[model samples]
Target: MKITIAEYLLKRLKEVNVEHMFGVPGDYNLGFLDYV
Candidate 1:
């Protein structure tokens, strides 16, 4: 049942019907992008 913050966030975004997002790709953003 362990989930990362990034995983949780992406899941919520999908629930709200978010199909795309824009952001700079960098070291800090890599973790979140892994979910996408």
Candidate 2:
């Protein structure tokens, strides 16, 4: 199985029990946001 960097980050957030997140979506982050 292949996991993207964004997916890995989301997994780590889940491990720490991060239920909510705040951010400003920009062109650079649009791809990363797809994992959310």
TM-score of each: 0.82, 0.85
Query: Over the stretch 1-36, how does candidate 2's per-residue lDDT look in tens digits?
Result: 998999999999999999999999999999998889
Q: Give me candidate 2's TM-score against the actual structure.
A: 0.85
- Per-residue error at 7 for model 1, in Å? 0.7
Model 1: CA > 4 A from native: none
lDDT of candidate 1 over 1-36, digit per residue (tens)? 999999899889999999889999999988788788
Model 1 RMSD vs true structure: 0.8
Which stretches of model 2 miss by more than 4 angstroms?
Answer: none
Show pairs that collide, candidate 2: none
lDDT of each: 0.90, 0.95
